[model samples]
Target: MDSREMPEPVSGHWPKRSSDAADHHPHVDLRPDGVTVRLPTPEVDWPSECDVTLARQISQAARELDVPADPAALQHLNVAVDALVIPEVLPFWRALLGDRDKGPEDLIDPHGHGPSLWFQQTDARRTGRNRLHVDVSVPHDQAEARIAAALAAGGRLVTDQNAPTWWALADAEGKEARVATWLGRD
Candidate 1:
């Protein structure tokens, strides 16, 4: 059966597309809370020349679905924590949080109720500050816009050592988070 016939969803609507054309579209993730419409790489600056093209394609596909597109409900988030000893300490966190292994360095809430936890490898632990850092993964195309939005809200850029992938930023009080993208990651 095609995606449309996968089953009428109980919560979220999928943007309809022809089975052959489906490969060109973003994925629609149906969750208990809401739905996330995501591309392999997020497009942040909507209305840009490139984004406009993508937007049109999505709009067309969404129109075919006969469902009102709700861009407002389309944001996805992931939390990442930097760690000095992933091999030694990951197990502790897994047991404490009752998380299951997603990979060699990641743990996930099997029920999808909690933010996904990814352990980033770091050489040394931070001295005074907390070692845990939050990483917000968005569609790759949305990274710039998300970063700009954060900065506009008083978040400071800590480092852009990795661009189009992740940008380390801190809040007014220096609490840290990174706006991440799937680019260069997979």
Candidate 2:
């Protein structure tokens, strides 16, 4: 079947693009609760040390809000965690990734997603979050339509950044998400 017959989905909406075209759009949802979560945009000037500090900051803020930051909230990423591949999880994911699993560290998604949803090993784990998150990116022209599609797919508009060419989108459960349209690597 042509890709048009099987367009990829963001969250749950049927986006208006071929599966190949959707690759240029990446959406990562940090949905702790399974359905909704807040989306976190990549720190443009990302530093290795930031994850730890950011986790701490989120925890402290959660205390102020009377809601604790579940370690899973700070741990699990909707996308691939690290470039390193765990042989343990690779086989299952390999089958899922199909021909894309040509090598370790190669990004793979059975769903025609943007990047390899890396499962970075972590120490802490906790209950799921109340919100779901997604990182979405599409072609410049497809940006608005893609965002609208996300809204149709049980998503809610969270935030947007005009300069960096990204939009922070979320689901109905207050989950975090991002919509970024950029050149695809694969």
Candidate 3:
């Protein structure tokens, strides 16, 4: 929630954080072990809708202890994830967000209220661990249009049996993304 939407505690005391926007700085280490970690937090002024979804992702991971997190802590935190895809994934998500293309190789939420995911071009196919990935859900009728849009932009189509309900899709380099259709539903 933005400062406006953050509910005050029953005691009516909220953290005295300033009104300045949060900066999603990259994690780096000047320490001896040289360990670095990016802490995922909500960017200030983020759209409530996007923040809500990100909070759900954070909470899901937190519940499984996959990541030590507090959804509440995400308030005013700026978090960004980069996706190095074959360009096609960008338009798919842009369309999903009902956003116009931001640039030749990038798209940003118009409101500047959501985490900025940078989609980059890289030659290496995704191997063992993905630093980041993306997924989407679309109506069945819109699936082909979505895929076509992605392909036109630079994405490739893929399918995997383990995931039966949705068509598996990937970038031209084999880095995977997904499109699940809301078809035959209640």
Candidate 4:
């Protein structure tokens, strides 16, 4: 089936394309909460035609089996490190993290088992705050709920200027995390 005809996810397990197109073979992780499905690398930022076809097949099979999905639980996590000069620090992280594949400003785990590492460029180094933070990317429809849940759990809203796309939040102790979504991304 084509992308236009692809079915919705059956059990919160919609297939997402890998960031790198060179890697083939879907990666399926069975977690206590649910399964996470990643389609073989796509040719572009989004899933390719073949990836969609495969997703449709997977969805169909899941439907046939009456599997349920919890879309709210779907999320992708990554670590972000602020760097004044990426090139100067990239190698250290690359070597320390093993042989992760490098993107323009990120290091991705080739095996898809670890959280991707993104390097954020900064003009000036800020004092008294951690240079690294965790970014949690959830489905667009679930971003608000997740943010609210974090707030309820003692996290404060650091910034919502990028709302609907991302919100910077901090724990009571000031450790930061970002709740993000695909919205506002092209």
Candidate 5:
């Protein structure tokens, strides 16, 4: 499934269920900002039927409890590190970050509190730009508003050629960050 096909929660909560048919319980994480339900595995682009059903149930439960959902407020943050030799740098970050979970090009926080780390491989050495940047992945519909807010706060658009997927921006001093979405990624 593409980004547009992904199911969204109705009450500002993300619900997830195990792919295992034997596990009937949905794990839910309640936070001050919102609720996140997770399975043993990370979220997939296309969720299973059970996952969708559990998401709906979680939404219903939230509504019953009068929980309001703010789609604009729902976002996931990650740190992107551009490296020419990822293998050489990956170990240091993993050790420094306290060893949670490692993917081929990413490091995820097992507890889901800290932002995930994504390593981008680059052939040429980058100049006049940061090697590390923040990636804020928000709902597709909210990207524009978020970009506008950042711009109004003195940030400038570095590039939007990747819009609907991401927009690179920079602070006054040129520190970079990207507002991204799952759109355009299949």
Candidate 6:
């Protein structure tokens, strides 16, 4: 099964100390440690769709929590590891990250603070290529600008076959990464 359709993090926040979007309500959970913004999306099967404007709101909420005003500091990241034999390797990672299995192919930080780790299965072994890449899921609308920024930073496009949804990119060292959005997953 494609896990992309799994529900994203559910809406939640502390009482009297939260800000949320109304329609597809994004949640702003203001905790002592910091603020956790659970961006909302339509009921379709995708992770979550965030609004770029929400980032500013989250930053303001973070400041209220006594954190810095840096937007990058509030971003969430996840890692995707491509493997041919998941069962053989999944356990080692589950033990290493101390994360709980969200599904047969995914793990999440028990603390809600670490980037999610997911395993993508491959049909045949590919040689001389990195098996891991970063899956940076940002607000759906911010994808193109982010892609452009990477290009400006000397990262070259690997493939855009999945573009407007996800772009495959390679860094100066040829390491691969994907700038993913919630566009096509719907």
Best candidate according to lDDT: 4
Model 4 earns a TM-score of 0.74
lDDT of 3 by residue, 1-186 (tens): 222232334112211111112322222222332222223333322233333343344345333433333222121222123455646577776787668445665555555445344465666655663545554544345556666777788877766453323565668776666554433322
**Alpha-carbon shift of residue 172 in model 5 (angstroms):** 0.5
Instruction: Kindly list the per-residue Cα lDDT of model 2 for residues 1-186, writing each as its tens digit.
Output: 122222234333322132224232223243334322222324321112333344344335334434433332222223533223366665676677565543553334434343545444544442454222344444345667767887999987666645246677677766666665532321
The parts of candidate 5 lying over 4 Å away from their true place are: 1-27, 31-66
Which whole-number lDDT from 0 to 100 does residue 4 have in model 6?
Answer: 28
lDDT of each: 0.62, 0.43, 0.43, 0.71, 0.70, 0.65
Model 5: lDDT equals 0.70
**What ordering of candidates by TM-score runs from best to worst?**
4, 5, 6, 1, 2, 3
Per-model TM values vs. the true structure: 0.65, 0.34, 0.29, 0.74, 0.74, 0.67
Question: Tens digits of per-residue lDDT for model 1 on 6-118?
Answer: 33562233344432244445456665444455443322212233333555575565556554554433444566677877888889988988867677887766654566677
Q: Give me the displacement of residue 17 in model 3, in angstroms.
A: 40
lDDT by residue for model 6 over 4-113, one digit each (tens)? 22122321332123333423445555544444555533232235434545545545554454444333333457788898999988998999987576778877775555
Model 2 residue 158 CA deviation in Å: 4.0
The reply for model 3, stretches above 4 Å from the true place, is 1-131, 160-164, 184-186
**Model 6: ten consecutive residues of lowest lDDT:** 1-10
Better of 1 and 4 by TM-score: 4
Candidates in descending lDDT order: 4, 5, 6, 1, 3, 2
| Tens-digit lDDT string for candidate 4 (1-186) | 122222345233343332134335567766554565666342333345555566556666555555655567667778999999999999899999996765767788877777888899999997888899999987678889999999999999999999887899999999999998767765
Model 5 scores worst on lDDT over the 10 consecutive residues at 10-19
RMSD of each: 7.3, 18.0, 16.4, 6.8, 7.1, 9.3
After TM-score superposition, the amount by which residue 110's alpha carbon in candidate 4 deviates from its true location, in angstroms, is 0.7
Model 6 misplaced regions, further than 4 Å: 1-36, 39-46, 49-75
For each candidate, how many residue pairs have backbone atoms clashing (under 3 Å)? 9, 33, 5, 3, 0, 0
lDDT score at residue 103, model 2, on the 0-100 scale: 56
Q: Tens digits of per-residue lDDT for model 5 on 43-162? A: 432234554465457556555556555667666788999999998999899989998556777888878678888899999899988889999977678899999999999999999998
